[model samples]
Target: MINRFLQNGLQGKYAHYQTDMLFNGLNWEMAGERPEGSHHSVWELLFHMNYWQDFILAELQEENPESPKDPSDSWPGSPFPSSEKEYTEMVTQFLKGLGRATQQASKDSLEESLGGRKRTPADMLMVLINHNSYHAGQVVYARRLIGAWPPPDGDESDE
Candidate 1:
């Protein structure tokens, strides 16, 4: 059975909307052009999430997939997605793919060792979820710092 709390909290329309706002909100800016000394922007975060999901899903299935090569530890570069629509689509696709993987994953499959670390597929899945949420929190903070992020879209009435 799925974890009801996580499914309710993290795998529903609410989660999708929150992810959308973070990646493609009206206040969101381009992935390029950082403010001087800082690194990462809304664009980079989206790109990072998309890239890793592609990587992990392919690896989990033992399929050979070619992901863009980036040397930066932070995976920084001009955003892989050239436009907001593309970014939004990529996020949507990954969420769908993740849901499928979770539903189909057997306990044995989830618990299979990868890289000799005994990482269950569940471990990898949660990493993607947690990692994205972590960056989403950062995006929220960045928006707050600039006073650009408004009350989230679904809660517009509160604004």
Candidate 2:
């Protein structure tokens, strides 16, 4: 049940869900354009979210992932996507990273401490979920700011 929320679909059985919904219908311009008052664009936010997911997944897999404590490192930019193809590539990678994180989180590690950080592996997963949820809200708000709400092709089932 918990595993379903992490990577499978946005049908969060435990509570709120819907990552894909926020991003479903965005085109290159909609995603890459920064709203008037917002510093970070939607694309940047999605990339940042994927970065943390990949980072945690690497740690869980015992890889020597570079732990970027700097905010800029966590929120780097890409060449402005000149076409939908480039934007699609980033979106695909972001979703893939999330799916990988989901697979990693499915492993049972309730008793294993995360790098002696005291929080167990399970706790770390919860932290990621919370983090993703926080940014997902921002994505929704960004969409609304651009009048991109109710994404034409997005999943609208059950909010």
Candidate 3:
């Protein structure tokens, strides 16, 4: 079930704005940069976000019988996607898989641990959100550094 709290909370707008921020002036190079010592690029960030969304859904299904058990999975390696089309497709597929999981998840199922110390489906979801936000920030900052980022939508500035 779609969490009414999330739908009503800032999370809804936060996720949407983040997506918009990433796509505003994106290009192949901007999406595929590793940038010196950093381990991920914009493309990698997107891939990672989609990947863990699937992972959380998979973990959630260890107890619940209704979740999709698809074997194809999201992606296989670091920076695997080369083109914008492929990168977009991977994220799209990941979101579709997440949609299936969200449809199947129950509040009780989300709270149950899948074993280990204290991992639960809700924990898994939280991890994905946190990770995505981290990488999304990096992507936006990188875009600015690379001179790819466009101006802010409104008059507001970080300063």
lDDT of each: 0.54, 0.69, 0.55
Supply the TM-score for candidate 2: 0.79
Top-lDDT structure, candidate number: 2
lDDT of 1 by residue, 33-127 (tens): 34343456655765666667667677666675675565464464563456667666766875676565455353445556765666656666666
User: Candidate 2 on 1-35: residue-level lDDT in tens?
Assistant: 55544544322334544564557878888888778
Query: Where does candidate 3 have its weakest 10-residue lDDT segment?
Result: 5-14
TM-score to true structure, per model = 0.61, 0.79, 0.60
For model 2, name the residue pairs that clash.
none
Candidate 3 local lDDT, residue 137: 67
Those runs of model 2 whose alpha carbons end farther than 4 Å from true positions after fitting are 1-14, 114-117, 155-159
Least accurate stretch of 10 residues (summed lDDT) in model 2?
Answer: 8-17
